[model samples]
Target: MMNYERLQSNINAYKKTGEILEAARFLIHQFNLDDENFAGFGFREELEKESILLTANGEIGEMQHVMIPKNIFDFDLTLVLNMLAHEMLHVRQKSPRMMILDKNEREWQAYYEMLFHTNFPQIPELSDYYKNFFGEKALIYYSRMGEGSELQLKYLEQKLEVEKFLQDIKNKTI
Candidate 1:
């Protein structure tokens, strides 16, 4: 069973930093990623950027541990969790040859699973591209990486379908 109370606590603890740290640890566990396989040892700097970034160096589909910036928890909790799912999935990539198919398929699967499997929580932001743009972004990223394949049609179709789905839900709620 999904633990809404626990998630709320992890994302909204008394100390914002503590909440984020808890959420990161919780998400790492949620995705079956190791808490210790990766490291976050840098001292907190007065970074002016909106947030920190993570880089995972490897061939496509190869699995890797990702470093999470502690600063990410400063964003909207739901948004940060969605971002966490996307960036961590980036830590595991497919080869360049299958980049188009693999990235889209994996991201779509991961996003739907993470969001819906959690029962859509009560966070409104979870319903939008802020949380559901994995497949869409995959299309943009991979198409730019290559000469742009015939799959552009399918990618566009998928993106349209998801957007329409979101819009339909919004309409029904209204």
Candidate 2:
């Protein structure tokens, strides 16, 4: 299905740059993604939406392409890894009949998954970096879902669950 050689080659090409290779490797291992379904990934200056920081494309729940902002390399490695992790979560959601998750629901899941590793007690430095930096971003992003009625309530529930999970990590209960 997947051409491991080509994927490894492509990932290796980013070794001289920031931690892009490491970030990709971490997600690949974390998700246990198939080689073929992975489609492929790249950094490009040309993206369909100028406002889009990154993009992930897939068909029937399998990731086909991931186009990242070339300038993302200029940021902190943790942020870059976090962004990649978020997009990959979207790619992961596509298959198995494309479960109909709402936009905020999907965003909550992606942000939660992206920040899940921050709970690891073994990697305190990484945990701290993510908690200090990206953790607030997650809160801010999900906060937008707290607006109006029934649908918003469901979104808020998801946001609260993620908040509690992060809090548990902060308290070292997890």
lDDT of 1: 0.49
How far residue 78's Cα lies from its native spot in candidate 1, in Å, is 1.7
Deviation (Å) of 168 in candidate 2? 8.9
Candidate 1 clash pair list: 60-93, 60-94, 60-95, 61-93, 61-94
Write candidate 2's Cα lDDT for 81-155 as tens digits. 566666666665654555535555566666666656432222113355465445566666566666675655756
Against the reference, the lDDT scores of all candidates come to 0.49, 0.56
Worst 10 residues of 1 by lDDT: 35-44
Task: Flag regions of model 1 displaced more than 4 Å.
Answer: 11-23, 31-63, 95-148, 154-156, 163-174
lDDT of 1 by residue, 1-174 (tens): 247567656566634655545566666565454422244222234355565554433455444445556566566665655555544545533433334345545555445434444322432346454433443554454355345465445456655655666566667657
TM-score computed on alpha carbons, candidate 1: 0.51
Q: Candidate 2: misplaced stretches above 4 Å?
A: 1-14, 17-37, 46-52, 58-63, 70-79, 117-129, 146-148, 155-158, 161-174
Model 2 accuracy (lDDT, Cα)? 0.56
